[model samples]
Target: MGEGNFNWSNEVLTRLISQAGLIALKLVLIIVLFFIIRALGKKLIGSAFEKYQKKNTVNAGRIRTLEKLSINVFSYALIFFTVVTALSNLGVSVTSIIAGAGVVGLAIGFGAQGLVSDVVTGFFVLLEKQIDVDDYVTVGGLDGVVEEVGLRTTQIRGFDGTLHFIPNREITTVSNHSRGNMRAMVDIGISYDDDIDRALSVIQEVCDKVSAEDSSFKDGPNVIGVQSLGASEIVLRVIGKTENGMQWAGERTLRKRLKEALDVNGIEIPYPHQVYMEKKADI
Candidate 1:
């Protein structure tokens, strides 16, 4: 009887060890598969973006946004499936766990509604092409360049060096300034005594020079005659169409050149003057 008991005990120990080894092996396989799938998914996304860029069929910013979103979604999905599979291999009932989670999610559905809305809105934002990564836009009353468009939120970098992470659902209206050529408008002011025709001619010469020297100008820097007759000066307007995001630089360059030309031609820019008269009162 004692010998029989010893044999039974030995068999139990061996089975336990075998079971543990199997579980460990499964866990390792799960981990390895996760990494493999993740790498392949990312590589696929990169290849797609590269192809799109080469073809020039889609906007570069749009391609980049899609690539980033795809990679993120793929990684999340892979991780979730890997965990569930691993749990099931370890003798856990994944189906039951998922059902329980669903019940809990339903109970908290109201609280999670905002999160759902954000995801839905983000999906639509990407689908509609309303805004793209690196595009200058005004959304939610904030003007900035979009850094990233994630599933839940968007990151914008403001001109003042502030980074704002806004929920996608809150972006009700988007004004994208990078979709087409931007207008560069510069108003030059000269003293009223200056020759209007001469000033216009000098400005035209400067505009032509700028248009020739800079490749950013897409349309004319043509003068629009006198814009306004101010109290002390006459304002002349010059306008040009420039590549998106190059309008400010073009405007500055044009203004500088216009000023130099005016100065060389003896045109005076009027400034506010206050004259104080001292009358000698009969003492």
Candidate 2:
């Protein structure tokens, strides 16, 4: 009786060890397959975009934006399926769990409508080409350069270097500034006493030089005559159409050149001033 009991106990122990080994082996295989699939999926997505770009005259930035979106979608789906598979491998009844989740999700769907709206809105935004990565845009009352556009949120880097993640549904109106030629306008003032005709002539010479030399300027940087009469000066507005994203730089260059030209011609750019009078305490 004792020998029989020992043999039975040993058999049970061996069976449990064998089952444990099989489960471990399965987990390892599952993990390996997950990594392999993720890598292959990203590689395939990138390859497809490159091929499409080569065959079409599509905008390079738009292609990059779509490529990133595709990769994000692929990764999200792959991770979800991988987690489900891993859970099933651990002896969990995935089918029953999924059914239970479906009921819970249905109940919670109303409160989560914003998520669905975000995804839908994002889809249309991408489809309509309202904005793209690296675009300077004003959306959701915020102005910034778009870094990424995802299903849930779009990333914006502000001029002051703040990174913002805004939901897609919040982007009701999009003002894309990087689409085509941008207007560069600079308002420089001269003293009310300075010669208007001389200032205009000096500015026109500058404009002609810029139009001839600066490749960024697509249209006139011509002096647009007097814009306004300020308290101490006459404001002259200079306008130009320049390459997208170069407006600020073009304005800076204009201001510098205009200042030099005005100074060389003795046209004083005015500023606020105060007159001081000394009162003697006792004479």
Candidate 3:
């Protein structure tokens, strides 16, 4: 009887070792598959982006965002499936766990409504192409350049160098300034005593020069006539169309050129002036 018990114990030990080895092998295979899928997924996303970029340079930012999102989604999906398969191989009931998770998820769905909304909104944002990475936009009352559009949130870098991560659902209205040509408007002020016609002529000459030298201008930098008559000066408006995101630079360059042209022609930019009078009390 003692001999028989020893043989059974030895058999049990060998079977346990074999089971452990099998589990280890399965785990290793799962890990290797995960990495392989990750690498292939990234490569596919990169290739897709490259092809789309060659066809649509203007939408490069959107394409990049899409590529990043696709990679993230692919990685998560692969990891989740691989882990579940590994668990099943290790004698765990993945179907039961998934069912339990579904019940729990249903219970928590109400509390996670905002998260769901954010995800849904983000998906639509990607589909609609309302805003793209690097696009200057005003959304949720904040103006900035979009850095990333993720599944749950969008990142924007403000002009003040502040980075804002806003939930996608919060973005109700988007004012995209990078879609088309932008208007560059500069108002020049001159002393009222200055010749209006001469000032206009000088401004026109400067505008023509700017239009010729600067490639940013899409339309004529023509004088839009007098904009307003201020208390101390007359305001003349210079209007032009520039490629998106180049309006500010165009405006700055045009202002500098206009100032130089006016200075050369002896046109005075108006400034606040006060004449003081002093009367002796009763000399």
Candidate 4:
């Protein structure tokens, strides 16, 4: 009986050693497969993406995100297939496993509908070019420059330097500020007593000089004439079209340069004032 027990222990030890060896082999093989998938994906899918980016002149941020996403996706695909192959080597029936997975996936699909929708929407966004990295946009009440666009979400950096992560599915309407030329608007205030025609002429002269100096101005920096008569001033509106991404800068420059010009030319910009009366002084 002791001899039999010794033989049983030997068998158990041998089996344990064999199982450990197989697991180690599988792990090594999986690691190799992971790298192989990454290399191939970069050469194949990533190469295609790179070419597309070059052709479309897509921003670098989008290109990098896409390349990374592609490599990861391929790595996962390789891992899945490698595991199945390893299982088949160990006498596991892949057919039965696939069948089981199909059912499980169907159930998970129903339960994770929102997640699936987000991924689907993200893919569409990438393919359709509805949005791209570096695009200044307003979406879902958040306005920012797109930092990264991913399969599940979009990242934006606001003017205030805040980073925002927005789910792709939640982005219903997008206002792309960099699509075309932008408008620069300025309403110059002058005292109501100042000559409207002369004030307009001065403002127009400033606009022309600014436009000529800065090529950012795409269209007329024309004076649109009097917009409103305020409490103590006449608001003369100045309008200009500037190249994409230069609107804000142009508007700021317009204000600074116009103010200086007005100041130099002695244009009277109005200030709030009050008058006082004394009955005794009048007598």
Candidate 5:
């Protein structure tokens, strides 16, 4: 009887060891398969995009944005599948776990509604081509150039070099400034004593010269006549159209050229002044 008891104990121990070894082996295989699949999937995605890029007449920036978003989505899916597979290999009931997760997700559906909205908004944003990488836009009360447009969030780099990540749902209205020709404008105030027609003539000459020389300009830096009458001077406005993202630099150059022209032509740009009287000694 003692010998039989020993044999039964050995048999149980052997079965347990075999089962544990099998589980370990399967886990290793799962990990290996996960990495192999991930690499192949990424390679396939890259090759597909490259082919599409050459064949399709879409903007490269938009294509790149889509590629990055696709990779993110692929990674998320792979991780989810890997986790589920690993759990199943451990003898866990994936169906039961998924059902439990569904119930819990429902329980907190109200709280998760924002996430859903974000995804939906992001989808529409992409579909409508509202914004693209490198596009300067104002949204969610922030002004910046878009760095990346993702499924959940959009990254924008501000003028001051601060990077901002904004949720898609919050971007209700987008003002894309890089869509067409940009306006380059500068306002110069000249003294009332200056000749309006002469000022206008010299300014137009300079505008004509700039428009001829600067290939960056799409249109003239012409003086738009008298913009306003200030307290001490008449404000003359120089307006020009330039390629997108060139407005600031173009405006600066235009302002410098106008100032030089005005100075050379003896047109006095107005400035604040005060006069003091000394009557104490006389009294």
Candidate 6:
């Protein structure tokens, strides 16, 4: 009876050891396969991304978005296949697991309807070429330079050095400021007492000087004579068209140079002043 008991105990221990070893071996194989597959997948994806980047017809932002999406999709598919294969090797029934996963997925999908919508809209935005990375744009009352266009969010750097992360779905209207030539305008207010012809001549001379000096002055610092006659002064408008994204710089330079020239030419930029009258009090 004792010998029988010992034999039974030895058989149980051997079976347990064999099962554990099989599981360990399978795990090692799965890990090895995962890395091998991952390396190959990355190589394939990288090559495709490079090709996409090289295509001049495609925008850079679109290329980057597609590349990231491709890599993510490949990784998720690989993981799913690995898990299913590992389970199958362990003699687990996959059909029931798949059915259970489908139910869970349905619940998740219902909860993530907005997220799905955002992703879909982002894809359409890329396809439609409405905007791109590095574009200066105004969307949702916020104006900024686009730093990144992502799957669910867009990053914009505002002039005040603030970074705004905007949801893809919230971007309903986009006004691309850097798409074409931008207008550079400066309104110079001159004292009403000053000679209009003299003021106009001084401004024209300055505009000619600026046009001769700066290649960035595209159309002109041409004077749009007498835009407004304000209470204190007559406003003369200097308008020019400049290359997109260079308007602010051009405007700033033009203003500075024009101010200095006006001061030298003795054309006054008028400021608010009031007149006082001394009269006898009414009886």
**Each prediction's whole-model lDDT (CA):** 0.93, 0.93, 0.92, 0.84, 0.91, 0.84
The full ranking of all candidates by TM-score, starting with the best, is: 2, 5, 3, 1, 4, 6
Give candidate 3 misplaced runs (Cα > 4 Å).
1-29, 55-58, 272-283
TM-score of each: 0.84, 0.92, 0.84, 0.80, 0.86, 0.73
Per-residue error for 241 in candidate 2, Å, reads 0.5
Better of 3 and 6 by TM-score: 3
User: For candidate 4, what is the total of clashing residue pairs?
Assistant: 0
lDDT tens readout by residue for model 5, 223-271:
8899999999999899999999999999888889889999999999988
lDDT of 1 at 180: 91
lDDT of 4 by residue, 1-283 (tens): 9999999999999999999898778778777876776676679986788789879976766686677666656767787877887777677899998989989999999998888888998888888777777888998799999877878888889999999999988988888887879999988899876777888888989998998999999997888998998888889998999998998899999999889988988898777778898667655
Best by TM-score: 2
Model 4, TM vs. native: 0.80
199 Cα displacement, candidate 6 (Å)? 1.8
37 Cα displacement, candidate 5 (Å): 4.2
Q: Write one digit per residue (lDDT tens) for candidate 3, span 217-253.
A: 9998999899998989999999999999999999999
CA RMSD, predictions in order: 3.7, 2.0, 3.6, 3.9, 3.0, 5.1
The residue-level lDDT of candidate 4 at 192 comes to 70
lDDT of 3 at 70: 84
lDDT of 6 by residue, 1-283 (tens): 9999999999999999999899989988997999999889988887887886787677665566566666667888899999999898888999899989988989999999878888887778777777777788897789998877766777789999999988888989989897778899999899887899888888888888888888887889788799998988899999998888888898898899889988998888988678899998999
Positional deviation of residue 167's Cα in model 3 after best superposition, in angstroms? 0.8
User: Which residue ranges in model 4 land beyond 4 Å of their true spot?
Assistant: 32-36, 39-48, 51-79, 82-94, 271-283
Over 1-283, each residue of candidate 2 has an lDDT whose tens digit, in order, gives: 9999999999999999999898889889888998899899999999999999999999887988999999998988888898898888788999998889988998888899999999999999999999888899999999999999888899999999999999998989999999989999999999989989999999999999988989999999999899999988999999999999999999999999999999999999998888999997995
- RMSD score of candidate 5 (Å): 3.0
| Model 2 C-alpha lDDT versus the unseen true structure | 0.93
